[model samples]
Target: MSAPSPAQADTPRSTGFLLLFALANAGGVIGYLPLLSILLPARIDAIAGDARLDLFTITVIAGAAAASLSNIAFGWLSDRSGGRRRWVAFGLALTAAAYAAVALATTPVAIVLAIVAFQIAINALLAPFLAIMADEIPDSQKGVAGGLLAFAAPVASAFSAMLVLSPFTDTTRLLLIPAAAALCVLPMLRTKPRLLAIQTVEKTLSPPRELAIAWGSRLLIQISGAVLSLYSFYYFQSLGTRPDLAARVAQVLTIAYVLALPIAVLSGRVSDRIGRRKPFLLAAAFTAALGLTGMAATRDFGMAALCFGLFQIGSAVFLALHSAFATQLLPNPQHRGRDLGLLNLTNTLPSLLGPLLAWTLATPQDFGAVMLVLAALAICGGLVILFIRED
Candidate 1:
C-alpha cells in the first residue's frame, strides 16, 4: 500500500462536516441506548415477571446474533453499492418501524422477535454510518472525531433520563425516542463527503494480526460494558434502592461520561499531536479495572455510584480513542466498510458473552462476583494491546 499523498494527509475536514457527523452518530446512540438500557428490560420484566432474567438473557442473545450478521452484511453491501447515505436512510426507516413493533409487543415471544428485528435494522444503519467516518474524515482528524463521538453517550443518556422521568407511558416513550433519533440523522443525509480511496500494487504491512489482537482487546472490554448496559439498573436496585431511585442513580452515572467528554477530547488532541494512542489506551483500561475492583468491594450506594462513575470515565475515554486507533489500522481502504463491520463483532460478541457471564455469576440481589471477573477481563484486555506495535 502506498502512503497517503501530502495533500490528503494535511487536509482537515470542515467544522460543519464534523458536527453533522457527530450528530449522525449520536442519532444511532439515541436510537438504541435507551431501548437496551432502560426500556427493553423493563418491558421483559413486565411480561415475564418471575422469569425476567431468563427472558432478558434470551432476548439479548437473539438480538446480538441479529446485530452481528446484519452489521457485516450491510457493511459489505454498502461497500459494493459505493454509497452510504441511502443505506443509512433505509436503515433509519426500518429502525423506526422496528421500534413501533417493540412498543406494541405485549408477550414475551413477540417482544423477543421485535427486539431481533430492531437489532438488525439498527445495525444496518450503524455499519455504514461508522464506515462513513473512515471514508470521509482525514486521519489527522480521527482522534478529535473519536473524541466528539463521546458526545453520543451524554446525549443518549439525557434522553434516557427524560424518558424515565416523563409522565408518558412506555409506549409513548418508545415512539418519542426514535423520533428524536431520526431528527438527529436527517442533517447528514443532505451532505456528501469526498471518499478516500486507497491504491496499492502490493500489501505493505501485516494488519490482520494486529487487527485480531485489537479485536480481542475490545471484545474483552466490551463484555464489561455489555453487562453494565444490560444490568446496571438492576444492579442499582439490588443495592436496596427503590425502582425510581435506581433509575435516577443510573441517570446520575451519566455524569461520568459527561465529564469524560473533555478528558477524551483533550486526550485525543494530545494523541493526535504526539501520535501515540497506546499509553492513553493502557491507562484508561487500568483506570476502568480499578473502578470495577472498587465497585466489587463496596456495597454502599454512594460509594458504588462513585466507583461506577470512575469506570464510566475510563471506558468512555478508551472507547473514544480506540475508535480513532482502529480506523488507522484498517488493512484495505477499499474494504473499510466490511472491515469495520468485522471490528463491530467486538461490540456484539460481548452481548452474548456478557449475558452468559452475568447469568452464571450474578443474581438479582448480588453483582459483586461479576464485577470482579469483569475487572480481570479488562486487565487482560489492556495487556493484549501492549503487543500491537504502533505504525
Candidate 2:
C-alpha cells in the first residue's frame, strides 16, 4: 500500500480537523465520568432516602440498552446510505444535542432521559465516524487511525480529570465536557470533508478464521479489563479516600491512555504489513488477562496504575488490528455497518453487565472474583475464534 498522491489525498486531511474529530470521540469519556461520580451517587442517595430502587437506575439501564440497540441500527443505516458525510454530520449533530440534554438534568428521571438521549445521539456519531475512517484512510495506514482513536482514551482521561477540578455546577457547565467537545468539533463542522459518490465498498466474504479468533480474543480481554462500570470509583470511595475516586481514576486512566497511543500506532501498522491478526490478538488477550488479574488483586494505587497500563497495552494491540480484522471477517460489504455495530456491542454489553456482576459479587477485598470471571470470558472469546473459517 503506497501512499496516495496529495491531489488524491485532497479530501481535507487538515491536522486540526482530523485531530479535532479524534478528540471529539475522546471527549465522550469526560462526559461519561459523571456516570461513575455523580450519577451513581445520586441514585444511591435516592435509594437510601426512599428505601427502594430509584427511577434513576432503571432509566439509565433502559437508556443504555436503547442506545446500544440503536447503535447497530444507525450503523446499518450509515452503511446502507453509502458512507456519506451528510449522514455522519447528522450523527454528530445528534450527539451534541444529547450531550447538551445531559447537562440540563434537574431530576434523576430527567438525568436518565438526558443520558439516554446522549447515548443514542453519541452512537450516531461514533458508528459513522468509524466507517468514515474505514472509507477514507488507506488500509496500509489504518494503524495511524487506530492509534488516533485509541489516543482518545488518554485525551479523555486528561479532560475528565480536569472536569473533576472544574468549578461549574450547572449540568451544562459543571464540567466543560460540552464546551470541549464543541471546540474540538467546531473546526470540522466549519471545514467539512468532501464526499465521493458512494462507491461499492470492499468487504470480506467471511472473516478469516484467524481474524475471528482475534475478535474472540478481544471480546474476552475487554470483558475482563472492564471493571470500572458502576461501582468502580465508588468502590474506591468506600475505601475511605478523602479525595474523589472518580478524579483519581481519571488521572490514572489518563496516564495509561497516553502510554497506549504510540504503541497502538506501531502495532496497527505492523499488523497491516504482516496481514495476520492472530498472534497479536493472542498476545493481547493474554496480557489483558494478566493486567486485569493484577488490578483485581492489588490495593496500592501505583500497582493498580501499572496494571491499567498493561491492560491498555493488550487493548491497544487488539484495537489497532481491529480494522484489519473487520475487513477480513465481513462476509457482506453491504452489512459492514450492521456487523461492525453488533461487534461494537460486545464492548457496551460488558460495561452493562460487568458492574452488575460486580455488584452481586461485592465483598471485602474479593474484587478478584471479577477478574476471574473476566479472564474466563476473554479465554472463551478467544476459543470461539479458533472455530471461525478464514477469509
Candidate 3:
C-alpha cells in the first residue's frame, strides 16, 4: 500500500465519529417509534381480544418481513445509487408518509399496512446509513463508533418515553423521527465525496464454510435477541405487570443498553489492542447468557431488571465488534452492503418468528424456556468468532 494523501487520510470510516453521531440521532428516532414496540402491540392486543396473541404474532411477522426484506433491497439499491443520500431521502419520505397515514388507520388491516410502510422506510434509511459508516470508518475508531451505534437502542427507548405519544392519539413521534432523519441526510446529499480509483486487488475473505458458520451464529443470536426485543413489553405484561410496569421494564431495558456502551467500547479497544476478537466476544456473550438465563428464573422485577442489564453488556460488546469482524471476513468490499445486509437480515427477519417462539415458550405464567433459549443463542454467537481467521 502506498502513503495516502492528506485528503484520503482524512476520510473517516462509516464507523467514524461524526457519522456515528448522525446515526445515533437518526437511528435513535427511527428505532424508537413509540407505537411499534409498546403501543402497537397493545393495540393488537385490544383488537384481537381473545385471539390477541395470535393476531399480534401475525403483525410481528409482517412487520419483520417488511423491514428485513426492505433493508436488503434498499441497501442494494443504495449501492447502485453510488451514494447513501438518495436512498435516505427516499426512506425518510416514505416513513413520514406512513406516520401520517397511521392516524387514519382504524382497523387492524389499516394499522398493519401503516406499520409495514414505516418498517420499509426504516429499513431503507438503516441500510445506507450503516453502510456509509462501514465504508468510511477506519478500523481504529470502529469500536467507539460501534459503541455509539449500540447506544441507539437506549436513545430510541428514551425518546419514546413520552406517554403523550401513545398509540391512540400521538403520531407526532413518527413525524419527528422521519423528519429528523431526512434533515440529517440533507447535508450529505449536497456534497457527496468521490471514491478514489484503485486497482482491485483480490483478497480471500472467510471461506464458504467459515461464512456459513458465521451466518448460522448470527441467525441464532438474532433469533434469541429478537424474542426479547419483539415481545419484552408483552412478556412483562404476561408477568402481571400492567401497562405502567411494562413501560418501566422497557425503560429499564433501555437503561441497560445505555450502560453497555462504555463497556463495549472499552472491550472493543482491548480486543484491538490485543489483536484478537474472539476473547472479548466470548467473555461478553457468556455474561449476557447469564443475564438472560437469570431473567428466566427471576420473579422479582428488580432481578429481571438486573438481568436486562447483563443482556445489554453482551449485546453492546457484540454490536461494537460484529460489523468490524464480519466485514473483515467477507469475500469482497465491493459487495459489503449485500453481505452486511445478509448479516442484518438475521437481526430484522427473525422477529417474524420471535413472537411465535415467545408464545410457545411463555404464555401468561411461563417464560423460563424461552429466555433460556435466547441466552443459549447469545453464547453460540460469541463462539463463532473463534472460528474466523484473523490473518
Clashing pairs in 2: 168-174, 205-331, 207-329, 208-390, 208-391, 209-389, 209-390, 213-385, 220-378
Question: What tens digits encode model 1's per-residue C-alpha lDDT throughout 1-391?
Answer: 1122222544788889888998998899999999999888888888998899999999999999999999999999998986688889999999999999999999988999999999999998999999988777877888999999988988898888888888999999999987999999989888855665443211333468888888988988899999988998778777885747736764765677688888888888899888889999999999999989998898888888889888888888889888988887888777888999999999999999999999999998899999999999999888888898885
RMSD of each: 3.1, 4.8, 3.9
Clashing pairs for model 3 are: 12-136, 13-136, 13-137, 14-133, 14-136, 14-137, 15-133
* Tens digit per residue, CA lDDT, model 2, 15-64: 56456656655654544544444444544454455421334335546665
How does each model score on lDDT?
Answer: 0.87, 0.60, 0.67
Residue 299 of candidate 2: its Cα lDDT? 73
TM-score of 1: 0.96
Position 388, candidate 2: lDDT? 52
Model 2, 296: alpha-carbon shift in Å? 2.1
Name the candidate that leads on TM-score: 1
lDDT score of residue 132 within candidate 2: 53
Residues 213-325, candidate 3, lDDT per residue (tens digit)? 66776676677677777677766665665547646865876688678867876776676667677777678778878888998998877788888788878876876677556
Candidate 1 least-lDDT 10 residues: 1-10
